[model samples]
Target: LLLFVYESDASPIDTFDLGPPNTDVTVHSAISTAELPNTTNTDLAHVMKLEQQPLTTCWPGRVLYLMASNFSDKQKWVACLEAAVKSIQRKDTIVRTGMFSKTLLELEGSRRLELNCSFALCKELVLLGADEGLFCVNLYHGTHAIITQLTGFKCVHQIVYISSLNLIILITGRERSVVTIDKRMIHSRIDQANSAAKEETNPIPHTVIEGIVGCTVMDASKCHGGSYMVVGMADRVLLMKYNSEMKSFCLRKILLTRGITL
Candidate 1:
């Protein structure tokens, strides 16, 4: 095997092939250069061209009993199975096409301890609730904006989108009390960012329900086409529903989990 390595520092070549007896000919440094592709670009190009190799390509008759005697053989079969499952799973995932293809946008700002995400009144908009504040992203235009008035919070526990009421209900707080902001006012501010947005805005009106306040909310979800929502706490599950005017969320019931002592 022959290996070719390009040297970066090129010294002047001193060769004695003159017409006279012993004349030395000196070559300039610009005569030779080390020209190679960037290491990162080469790696990314290699990764893009790579494809998964199936285990059955070598072993012909392992369809019935997929058994392996060694660890390396087991890993090959696992890789093949994972690749096959991913191919089948992508077909079941939902996709929403825009006016054009998916655009890649580079994010500018930063956030600490990202917690939850919820869809806005328009399906294309996404609300990202982090520990610092709430950030908005327009999926259609691929733009990001921060809701200035929605700051000064401990931690964002969960975010749920109530599409029927055009509201984004999110829970935030670490201990003592969990604040729930269920209102359409925040949605209008996000919508206004696209049409007519301004600075120095007032605080959005919201209510705080105490059913799952002290308990740590593990997860929050809203039923499809239903007026009810469920919040999974550390020990119990909280069930809530919107009022007739769709203004505030009232606790309907709580499903407590039985605890056992060791």
Candidate 2:
């Protein structure tokens, strides 16, 4: 048969005629465009001017650089691409677990800080112990301000909060003595100081822990919801228990270590 075909859609299929068959005729099927792989280069430099701040896109095996018409459009494109990357990375447990590296709040201070160490008393409050003095900072406040300062101690290294007795123990580095402050007294003084004048010369009243030489590490059971305390010195470890009668902590047992180091 003899076949006539038209490439344009303006002509109907019935307009073509099929004549008597001829043995010399040959027919071939068409190859689909979808079956062919894209071999064209997708480089942004070749597509547009290089000064447009193009963005690079990445996948498993293929990479493409996309260009935007303007700078604002480029920013939007970059933001969208970053969001997509974060969405995929979040599916990984290890990656999601370590993603919180952003800083939420920063400590602000007016004077020069000589901070040696710090301790978190609760979710909102943190105790900063320094050579200058001890400061109480509120973390959730708008300003993150140091609400109060307790003077009378220097070279403070470690701080412990005892909830049972409402006491705060301060351990000075290399000092043989420790300072104890009552939480009730601290709160009362804070209220008074807010309306009263600032006193720089007078120091706050605190109990002094004496007779312990070279006090290095001091931990209390109050830290663990107990009433006992353990103090590690240069040569010995003292086990002290709280005495409710006198409203103070007293030495209950002392283990001396002459040949062993604390």
Candidate with top lDDT is 2
TM-score of each: 0.46, 0.54
Error of 1 at 208 (Å): 1.4
Cα lDDT computed for each candidate against the true fold? 0.47, 0.58
Task: Show model 1 residue runs off by greater than 4 Å.
Answer: 1-115, 118-124, 140-154, 176-183, 191-201, 214-226, 258-262
- Residues 70-99 of candidate 1 have per-residue lDDT tens digits of 546555655654565455435533331231
Question: Candidate 2 — which pairs collide?
Answer: 1-20, 1-21
* Candidate 1 minimal-lDDT segment of 10 residues: 23-32
Tens-place lDDT digits, model 2, residues 1-262 = 1122546556443321111111111111222234223423332222211111112223222123334555566666556545544454455445335444545345555655678778776676667787766776657764544356765667787888877777888887456477678876665665566557543323668987767667777877654554877888777888887777866678988888774334
TM-score of 1: 0.46
Q: By how many angstroms RMSD does model 2 differ from the true structure? A: 20.5
